[model samples]
Target: KSTVINALEDLSFYCMENLPFDLIESALDHLTREKNGPQRFAIGIDARDKRFVKEFKNLTEKLRKKFRLDVLFLSSSDEVLAERFSTTRRKHPLLDVGGELIAAIQHEINLMQPIELAADASFDTTLWSPHYLARKAEERYSGADLHRKLQVTVVSFGFKHGMLKPADTIFDVRFLRNPYFDPNLKHRTGLEPEVAAYVFEDPATDIFMEKIVDLHSFLLPAYYLEGKHYFRIGIGCTGGKHRSVALAERLVKDLAAKKIPNVELSVSHRDVMIGQGI
Candidate 1:
């Protein structure tokens, strides 16, 4: 439930966990009537109940007349599940009746087979991290508008924390002057105007920005033509608190100013507060 809930948090959907199979219709009805309520809803169900699987499918079909429905089944290898359970030191819900953990996992898998077959989409999380899984789900659930447009995510990170794997392009800003060397600006983050100004004051920063923006402007349409919907660009420096963040913000601003048709832009600072004292 946490996995599903966390993944959907970034989207506009309102989520309910551990919803009884019987109440799905009621929930949908309530959502539809509310003036300001979210049109998208994510309901979580426990797959351990074999009796509800068929009934749930029936309910989903009935609800489809009223709303768009996309059923996603999430699963993983037994070995991976076992490893997760072992690492977390938590008993499986099906561990009752004196069954071994592996047996319980197998039993649950058997019960989930019907739902898996009926699912519109399925994901195997054996090798996926939670963030990556969330990204995949978001991509899968994005509206039709997103299909026509390229969604660009510009992320700022510190090299010490490692590179962002999902990045389609990575730019290093370590060559810029270090703000950390100055006592007054050492603790400031790039979101602060002073820090941003200091970071962008270098002549090299201007040249770099122009080149990167020009490259993206040239490449974005090509990627769009190739049917690519999402692109993650990474900006990294020694500490994410300063240069990377400033550059990422500026880049997005520049891109937005260009008004690239059918392009959506977003930014995130992944490690901005890593070493902050307060």
Candidate 2:
């Protein structure tokens, strides 16, 4: 559900994650009273939120009458949830001291049964990747703003920082030249022209991009046709300071140059200042 919430945030919705259930009405009241507050909002709720069951049981009907409230219950098979926890090596939110993984997953499911029964919509995301879930979320919750063009998010990350979650496509640029080896360039990032120029000076860089651009040109139309509104491409290198960032930026530029119909592009370098303490 974090993936879906993040997708809404990209669409300019004011988001509050894991908010206390009892504060829902008061929070909306305050947000509405502000002079220039957001018109759209996405609130994230789960079994772990304070007084979650109590609020749902006591106030869902009242809140729905007062506002255009929606409860989108997201669930997955217990096996899938267990596998994800193992892969990410993260504890389940509901895990108790000395509890087993499967037990924790089952416990959360049992606890949230009431909310599931009351949800206006429910999505079973057993096979969905994070990016795919993000796209689905936008389609499900964006109201009437559904005719917007396909949006692609290009993200640059470092392998050392751990693999980026929720990426649709990931490209490793570690084979590219190492700007970290150059004293003058080590402190700089790919956002700088000098670092970018240095990284792309390799003849193979352009050749690789040609194939990548071609591949996406063929793939994006299919995604758009299927009603997907969001895609994320992850670029990774050893440090994210140079090669990955440079390649990601180049990819954005190359795609923009294509001017593919009904497409919008944006880029972010996720770990550009990790070790620099900037």
Candidate 3:
């Protein structure tokens, strides 16, 4: 369970481990009001909390109505659990004074029945490695990128609006040709064909794309091997209406190439519609 929670944190979820069930709704309200809180969240509930186990269904039903939820119940065999506690030389949470290890394991399993039965998914981890379990947890929540290992977020923003927020890397397409100066293309965004054509038509953009593609082709796989969960790339321009947006699209296309395996790609034009009636 700790491994899974850590994996969710690596995926940029704001995680609360061993969170008491009673405070969950109020905690979510607090997260919503924070100036820069995470939109994604993962909460770990302790089965040892008797009230939580007794009220699991009601609390989860309330949570589901207000927020999207998935409950993952993780357990191992009694023998394996007993061995783990013995190896760690630690007392079991359910163990009574001078109680037997196997007995405590069995008792906890019985206590966890209500939760395991109600969970969205349940996994028996007697033979599973922590790495394998963490990977499984990441894959379960990472969306349709089952075949990929890294998530890449490419966002285009205007320096005029603000510096791109907390990206892993940023590229200034401000050096590329500006479509804002063109009378006809001035009102258009890079999503339009003419603006995209004008931006990509620049010889400098072709060289820039080549260098970027070369750099990330190596960087993406290196980061994946380093066990990175996600990468954010920011593309900035003087005004996000044109050049940055166009190059961002082109970069997404280049990133989709077969050479970049196990990479999930997505792009956002952050300030594209700021001045427009969007």
Weakest ten-residue segment in model 1 by summed lDDT: 139-148
lDDT of each: 0.82, 0.83, 0.82
- Clash-forming residue pairs, model 2: none
Residues 98-131, candidate 2: write the lDDT tens digits: 2999998898898888889988678899999999
Residue lDDT tens for model 1, 31-80: 88999878778887765555577586677677676765677888999999
Q: Model 1, which residues run further than 4 Å from truth? A: 143-278
Clash pairs (backbone) in predicted model 3: none
lDDT: worst 10-residue window of model 2: 61-70
> Residue 51 in candidate 1 has what lDDT?
52
By the lDDT metric, which is better: model 1 or model 2?
2
Collision count of model 3? 0
Writing each residue's lDDT as its tens digit, candidate 3 over 1-278 gives 77899998988889997677678889998997898877778888765677888888898787776665677899999888888889889878768822887887888888889889988788889999989999888887774533446889889888888899889889988777778778898899998999999998889999999998888888887667544668999998877878888889889998897458778999999999972321
Candidate 1 to truth, TM: 0.50
Query: All candidates' TM-scores?
Result: 0.50, 0.51, 0.50
Candidate 2 residue spans exceeding 4 A from truth:
1-146, 275-278
Candidate RMSDs in Å, in order, are: 13.3, 16.0, 16.5
lDDT of 2 at 79: 97
Q: Report the Cα lDDT for residue 188, model 1.
A: 87
Q: Which candidate, 2 or 3, would have the higher lDDT against the true structure?
A: 2
